[model samples]
Target: MTPSQLRSRIKDENFCKNIISYLENIIKEDLSWINPAFEHLISVSSDMESTIFGSVSNCIEDKENTKHNLSDEDKGEQEYFYSGKM
Candidate 1:
């Protein structure tokens, strides 16, 4: 189901209680199966985080390299503005 549909269902008191009850039963009886699922979720989350951070780091590096290539006069102007001397 879509996120919006899932959210609407969760808002219903009965559905929420049913889900909680089901999870409790699963935890009590099927914890062995849940362990692999939890591990997979953790691995996927870690991979996504590293990918996002790596992209951001590359963008920042590119911006810094561009700034480094600026002429001395332009660098001085940028420094002056950043130093609140503008």
Candidate 2:
């Protein structure tokens, strides 16, 4: 999330400004289905008092599960997500 975007959504508007880049990087890695982000999230997640990592993990897992469970008509959506990750 960008600092400005996060500021609009979060109560402590200014707090995320410092860690926005970290969040963005981790999101990119997470979307790419890489293990590093979650693997190291525990050691560095002290900055996040929320369940951001857990939420991200769940979202990715849901995506993978949906990909496997999709019907033919829903299959095209997977390509859209894969291209976006690229």
Candidate 2 ranges beyond 4 A from true positions: 1-50
Q: Kindly list the per-residue Cα lDDT of model 2 for residues 16-84, writing each as its tens digit.
A: 665686788876774555566686786667656457877888999998777788887677766767789
Give Cα-based local distance difference scores for all models. 0.90, 0.72
Instruction: Compose the digit string of candidate 1's lDDT tens values, residues 1-86.
Output: 89999999999999999999999997788457578779989999999999999999998899788997889999888899889977
Backbone clashes per model, in order?
0, 0
Q: Give the best candidate by TM-score.
A: 1
lDDT of 2: 0.72
Evaluated at residue 71, the lDDT of candidate 1 is 93
lDDT of 1 at 11: 95
For candidate 2, give the lDDT of residue 3. Answer: 73
- Model 1 earns a TM-score of 0.42
TM for every model, in the order presented, reads 0.42, 0.36
